[model samples]
Target: MTTVTAPPPPAARTATPAPLVSVRGLQVAYGDGPLVLDGVDLDLFPGETVALLGSSGSGKSTLMKSLTGFAPITGGSAQVAGHDVGTLRRGRLRNLRADVGQVFQQFNLVGRLSVLTNVLTGALHGAGPVNAVGGFSSADRQRAMALLDRVGIAHKAKDQARTLSGGQQQRVAIARALMQRPRLILADEPVASLDPTMSHQVLDLLQEIARADGIPVLVSLHVLHLALDHSDRVVGLRHGEVLVSSPTAELDAERLAVVYDVSDADQEADDAGH
Candidate 1:
């Protein structure tokens, strides 16, 4: 007979390990369009949740995409899980993506599939299309079932994805991401479609996962208060640049207000015309 025990505390910040995801002087553009990310820099360390805060068009989504080579990286470098995203060829890029797990606002599930089956699909990331249908091994299925239990939705494993409520479905999405055994997790506005009550629950769960799994979670969020509540560090972007980056313990809504202040953008334009 055995009893579960909590793990020991992490080493001091000075002794913290190197970041799993590192971005430096990053830039992204889409075919003659203006730069969407300009000299952006970010880092995600293990056992931490970094809330990415910004209003619309702040380049939050682009930064996330650049990590896995989904965004066209025009300048600088992004090292994710030890892979240089900007320099990776197609074959290696696929490996880079397999190392990162992603969550979305829409909860992107195959509505007709069972929750368990959907989670199992995460194991298909590196496997070729040959295993897309009915090819999961017993170990993969066991892991998927365990992930569902970890996310607290094991009871709903047999339910159709379309039948679950918004919050429950999001939990399943998270379980699916965990199925990938991801080194870093990126959640793009995962709570945007959820109600306030559900929002807190989902965010709380993400933070818990970060701490327990020792995996860094970089979550983009539009709501300032939610970021304040759910993250260990806060990185706020404005007009494709990082306006503020600090530990959440040192920040408040007042300090974060500039990220959303439209007048700042107007002021920049005014100065540019000079």
Candidate 2:
């Protein structure tokens, strides 16, 4: 008789790095309007993908904007890459933005430029004014090509950005963001315009980048299933407040339903009319 024993279980995962982006009691509002984001707190750790979820007007976009200084913070603190977002001077703010890469729903790209050229533009985030005659350097061009290849679109590097399909255009946008070597990535509704398949592909790519580069990716998403399927953590907002924050493995559609619940007035009105 021979005795067999299974190998001991692997060691528990190491503690995560200090948060690259931190927010506490964050509040935001437009002039004279009600608070768009209220009493929100969030922390983004390196090599993690966090999904922001909410229905329309739920403050998801406002929260993302606050992280980059686009939204006015009425109270609380938001620190990104060691800079206090609300109190940073203009130059420091520019430096902060340079360290943070952004992807938008619209795939903000210059349609007329070649995909490679568009990616190179990412290097301009914190760069001084360029000499029109000198243009991009050989090193910058090579780096841009490499990023395009990483995104699986090196073949489209020579094509006009406008000529590619929606998925392809998004790949170009992602490559462009990577060209910045960002410490944090903010993706605001990044896949809202894509079909279901493209949505999965794009989200998968974002998570891969987060893990491989040790960058924190905070992406706002409308689809519940997508968040559950792609993100490591989920933060749900409702009526300008955080309603839920937990690991994706511990959450499901039932647990998230409260984030999008209808108001009492609406429900009563429906019953009265019936």
Candidate 3:
């Protein structure tokens, strides 16, 4: 009789909660140009605020665009909310884009529109276009007001978006992103134009939203102290690659210096994308 041996039981593995956004060995380039991002790996989990830190040209913006299907992924795999972004069809790509909420540095709200109407535009993400902004349903109007209130700007709902302060306008932009009822949020330098006080407030609100709603928030930042103070985690990029990824408590300005090729971490810009 041949000797037979039973295989040993498999090793017990630690349980890790699935990430809302997951990327592995990601690479991005444009039309034969050199890679903008190279071999990046990242994850954004629920109920966390992750800041992206890097100098300009460090692939911050490009990383973000990849998640929405705007940046071309030349290699690796990106799975977002269960969708394989690299191989998605156009229709699926549209659906993928609809699920992610975006906030910009310039506060991309319609200057001529009422703040309430601007917030309602977010509801159009998954829903098809309507006859007009004025034609939004009363239910949506109520939800818009609720989002504005959540962002602490419900009183400005009737005012034109351009009439608000820079900080308040940024708040409106944030409320608009919230109105989407998004599964994930990408804030690309959302507080760059605001005063220091407003920046803190906005960051605080984002953190609260992540906790209350159990969603991940990925914010790109240019200021170092803000990233340290505002985010629960930090992801530092250097020349299109992730140099450091750690809990905020474990990193300091000196620890992040290499990301900027500097003597200290007072410079730059996250969970990441693009």
Candidate 4:
């Protein structure tokens, strides 16, 4: 026997990298209302796409907002890109937002602007007043075009953003996110407005971006199959708590259904009311 032991398994691969986003015991509420997120813990490492799965009102969007300092952190802590989101000052919060790229269900583009200009607007994040007045620089224009090309829409760059189809507009939105050079990407039901085919395409592009750029992508999705197909890991939320967290490889529709399971008390209430 050689007894080589496979070179000590390559030193255990140097341990996994530190998470770009870490949330511990996170809790959120809205102006004395009920808790939206309770004791939620999450971690997002570089180059990974983590799907956030939940039904309506499951705190999925609130969790994303917590990471960006948009939600009220009633308790616990959330750290994104090394900034403590719950305690960040105004300027630092702006920096944190700048470092994050956000995609929404409705493509939030200036309809009147050209596709190229819409993409370039992403660079305005954390910019000074002068940059806004002077307009985007030539370098910015070049980079915006390059990003549009990368998203497979260079030819449409000159057209008004609203002129593109849903899928094409979503692509432009993604390119705009890329224009931010984000350290992390947060997509809140990004594919909710698209057809199944376009949903697949946009999710595929987001995963590719996460891997290629080594950035963490946290995407909230209502569709089970899409999450199963696209993510490296899955975090399932239910009634403001994490009900399931596991590698996507080990998850299926049956396993993930727990996230959406109705509680006995609620079911009893429904039955009684009926």
77-171: candidate 2 lDDT, tens digit per residue: 99999999999878888898999999999999999999998899898874556623337878888999999999999999989999999999999
Per-residue lDDT value at 233 in model 2: 98
Top lDDT hit: 1
lDDT of candidate 4 at residue 31, scale 0 to 100 = 92
Q: In candidate 3, which residue ranges exceed 4 Å CA deviation?
A: 1-15, 128-134, 263-274
Deviation in angstroms for 140 in model 1? Answer: 1.3
Compose the digit string of candidate 4's lDDT tens values, residues 12-80. Answer: 456889999989999898997899899999999999999999888899999999889888899999989
lDDT of 3 by residue, 87-151 (tens): 99899998888788889999988999999989999888756456244467788889999999989
Per-model TM-score on C-alpha atoms: 0.89, 0.89, 0.89, 0.91
**Which prediction has the highest TM-score against the true structure?**
4
TM-score of 1: 0.89
Where is the poorest 10-residue window by lDDT in model 4? 265-274
lDDT of each: 0.90, 0.89, 0.87, 0.89
Residue 1 of model 4 has an lDDT of 62
How many backbone clashes are present in model 3?
13
Stretches > 4 Å off in candidate 2: 1-13, 129-134, 263-274
In model 1, which regions exceed 4 Å deviation? 1-14, 128-130, 263-274
